[model samples]
Target: MDSVLARALIEDPTEDGRLPLFLLFLAFLATFLITRTITRLIRAGKGPFRDRVAGGVHIHHAIPGIVLTIAGAFTSVAVDGSSPGAEIAAVLIGIGASLVLDEFALLLRLQDVYWEREGQLSVQVVSLTIAGLGLMAIGIDPLSDHTLSVGHLVIAINLPFHVAGVLMCVAKGKYSTASVGAFIPPVAWIGAIRLARPHSAWAKRHYSSEKRERAADRAHRFDDRYGRWGLNIEDLVAGKPTASPAVSGQEPSDPKGAA
Candidate 1:
């Protein structure tokens, strides 16, 4: 296995330094899965591990994640080439990223809200990260590679087309689509031409009352159609969200209160 890996890293002419990136993805996935398992077990009160507290203050895993991320980033910058050192640095960075992203809700909300609905943000972010990395692993290079074969003049002429597509997708509030479309132009075109989501700024600015109603209806139908699938995926990845206790007959208030 080591020999095969070494050959792929060193002898493959088509690698283009992607081996380290592939390793990074593997490391990130492993680290994230392990971290999620441990956290879920802790939440269920079934793990040998317990939350770490020092001097009456709980220590969140994000602290170590931040340290590892900084260390790995600096190490990668200082390392000069696509050697084993670079691979190790990539692994460190991946692990750190997984740890940090696992607690993304804490960072975003500035509080501990793991196991709550808001915690689903972490799962979403991780899922997107995994998809992006997987795409890269499969040789999808975003915008930068699109003009590789074209002459400079042709690239210059085509640049506006790509830029317009990207902008249109963004304006429609399809950020994930825009990101993928930046790499693959057809995706961007589709996103650009699609109706804006009801709450998107584009809808607010350009949609007439009737158009807004239509957009709203589309958004509602979409949510109704796919929301359950999304929830299932989130639960599979990050464990099921724990609901807060209701007060009287009303749904529980937001744990963090209204901002």
Candidate 2:
């Protein structure tokens, strides 16, 4: 017999029409964890893995990630949703997306900031992406769940309002909320109604000095209460920055040019 997890994921999915997404979430999460482990080991000079270098250029994993993402996305779009081809495409997309997000900071900076303090952005981005995927896999879609009714129709019709909530949260510098709000309408609505971060565009452009001070106070309090836990989690998942990590002078991984 298969294990309990297998039974839940493959045999008896918790939600209707979400098995493909569940598979994708699992694939993405597993791929990201494994890739981060290898990269961290390479950075610490503790494992067999090393950076990838071409004839003379360094090769980043994002290149192949981009290829796989495009190929899988097109295949997923082309294939029947319930078919095995769609499942394969979903897994490919998940793997490719994880690989790309694992070095998100590097892409934004256009350099190997993978082992620097700025590398934390990669972890943050990957975490948000995973959270969004996990929510979707668990059936937290943006609108109605395919059930047809007046209320469902209204909710679906108000999709633009929900989207605005997501954008509002982003503008207010509530990224964690924005990540959830993108999938769950109520969460975004709440974030949109909350106080904007003091340094955010919304706060800068709209808030009075007194209101900004209050926002800053609240932001700091929240950070002081929760930032340590977040940092610890990030470090645990992606490894902490070293004084002089391998990316300082070394190259990317996958020497056979598979990176």
lDDT of 2 by residue, 1-259 (tens): 1232243345444346677788889999999889988887887789789889989888898988898889899999898685787888989899999999888879987978787644555665676577667645755454645534454455456667777777686667665555555556788788788888776668788999999899877777777776456445446665766555435554321111000
Write down the lDDT that model 2 would get.
0.69
RMSD to truth, every model: 8.0, 9.0
TM-score for each model: 0.62, 0.62
lDDT of 1 by residue, 17-49 (tens): 777778788888899899999988888899598
Model 1 clash pairs?
A: none
- State the weakest 10-residue window (summed lDDT) of model 1: 250-259
Error of 2 at 153 (Å): 10
Supply candidate 1's per-residue lDDT for 65. Answer: 89
Least accurate stretch of 10 residues (summed lDDT) in model 2?
Answer: 250-259
